[model samples]
Target chain A: MTTGKGAATRLRIVEAAAAEIRERGANATTLDDVGRRSGTGKGQMFHYFPQGREELLLAVAVHEADRVFEGQQPYLDELTSRAAWEAWRDLIVEQYRDQGLYCPLGVLISDVGRYSPASQAVAAQLVRRWQECVRAGIEATQAAGEADPELDADRTAAAVIGAIQGGVTVLLSTGSTEHLEAGLNLCLDRLLL
Target chain B: MTTGKGAATRLRIVEAAAAEIRERGANATTLDDVGRRSGTGKGQMFHYFPQGREELLLAVAVHEADRVFEGQQPYLDELTSRAAWEAWRDLIVEQYRDQGLYCPLGVLISDVGRYSPASQAVAAQLVRRWQECVRAGIEATQAAGEADPELDADRTAAAVIGAIQGGVTVLLSTGSTEHLEAGLNLCLDRLLL
Candidate 1:
């Protein structure tokens, strides 16, 4: 049996909206723009999202949040060896580089203030989950005896996350991945040292 | 003799445009919006910026570049002691926290694709200057024996800057300083260790 056509259309709408939001910012992207980009009629969009632009934005936020983890998966989970670390780093660099300067996660999160509380909660949850994944990686690195015994896993994880964010900001500013490379190298080097 | 009225009006227009861009994003802010926000009439705005919106945007880009350095000044020049480092950290955190989620640098950089070559050049200069300051700080720390002699100043400086950018990105996403704190602590801890 095939999945429901309505669900597929809804997913398509969300994906299209995410793309628009990434290309233009939250404020610049409109429901009409999403409709045009997704090749969906206004009625269909309203049928899927009765609450209008706000609801559709929330959907996009969730989708983008999920993509954040999905895009970094497997690599984000495996930090047991130097090769694995380098692979993860390359994946990260490629992900951002391929996307150019547009940051889907940042765009979604930036509009949280204008979005409903539920939307903000979704963003918060996404961040917490992302941090937890980093925490797990740090714990695994420590367990593998690769990091300092006294290092706080949570703190180290937070720092790694921070470094990636900082590097991404620079990448966005300068359209270069040098900062991202530096961040990943520094964090891994410190861990191994 | 005082500066010419034309020059003064031009400065006012740029300052207002920068504020509007920061409060609202690049795409959301318009020439009309800048005029309204800056208390300049349409004719006056045009008189000062003959090249229209792009000219004004370039001006804002330059102003933002200056602010980035001004914001990190004094401390960015001196990171020889624990107190100095802490002061710099405080300045970094306070700068982002005070600005809330509005990233002027991000706003300018995001629109670089649509800007004049001069604007892009200004942004490039800003990053190089920012990186130089970071490099200077690391060198000072090394000279004072605060950091390991074996550590490469350029790489360490790049890492520190990257971590700060990463932290700032997270801060922008989550609207919290926890990640920023983590990045600063990690960098300092590594140096002290």
Candidate 2:
């Protein structure tokens, strides 16, 4: 949340670390590699991330989490109509399918130790944000009478998130979009009148 | 698939490894530790798993997979009635909640390299087997007019699996079964008459 040259430099390092991790994986990427890629030095890295690699990975997790949301884009924001909902679902399916077995945020979290307090906080925040978006969409559709008015938007949206996460997990292992599509379709089917 | 003393010894080794992993973690376990826990020597360990830790981990993956299925018990097999279906759902949520953030098969798969062909085969097999059970239940209920007759059982079952998986993933990160419970309820609501 800082500003100016220092903030820019910090961002550059994060971006570089993300790129390196994406290319060679988080396990293989090192501080030196990030420094070389970002054109930063040990001094600057320490100044920015005093705790070193773990801190940097968490930073990249935030970046990746942002990308996941950003990738959802306009569709995620506008789920008032059936068409928008389907489009959002399709976008999610396509993005994961394209990525196949490698999920950026997943790898970063895995490297950061998924159960660690820091990683858990970031993951929980990301999940909450994602759930809130879907909840908003559900509320919009419900108000318009496009979805079941009696439905609990927050709980239903949480279910929708679970549906996608489950489908994505299956897709990650089996390399198929069938579950992803079917799961999302089922959630929509339940919601849409 | 072998039988006799050799197979017994091999299973003993696998069980010991699984126990060790459940107690500690995959990364912290070693062949020597497994061997010691199993009351077998290096000779027996190598004889059972010539390819070493990867092979052993894959074997444990299979064991863990079996445990996942077995944990579901009579509920997984008899999901024809609404009562039975709810029971099955509760059992899943309870087991995962009890385990909390630690999913044995999940940890094993992660350690064995989730994307590797060997791990994929094991995971794919587990998913297929689980989906088949759900599919069978859907088919059974449909025949009796207890559930939606027109729903595609296979696809719906796959979606159900995705729902559980997604909920489980969220639970692993957030340590709450709310998403898992909500997701399963949605699926049941859609299916049950």
Best by DockQ: 2
DockQ of 2: 0.67
All candidates: DockQ: 0.55, 0.67
> Which candidate's lDDT is highest?
2
The DockQ for candidate 1, computed on C-alphas, is: 0.55
lDDT of 2: 0.85
Candidate 2 interface RMS: 1.9
Clashing pairs in 1: A165-B166, A166-B165, A166-B166
Error of 1 at B116 (Å): 7.3
Off by over 4 Å in 1: A1-3, A22-28, A37-39, A109-119, B1-4, B36-44, B111-120
Give lDDT tens digits, candidate 1, residues B1-193.
Answer: 3269777877888888888777666667788888887788999988777788767777787777677777778898887877898899999889888855555555555564423455556655766777788777777888888777777777777778888777766666556788888888887777643
Q: Mind giving the per-residue lDDT tens digits that candidate 1 earns over A1-193?
A: 3259988999999999988877776778888999999999999999999989878887887787677778888888887666777888899889888856555555554564423466556655766787788788777877887767688878888888878877777776666677788777777777764
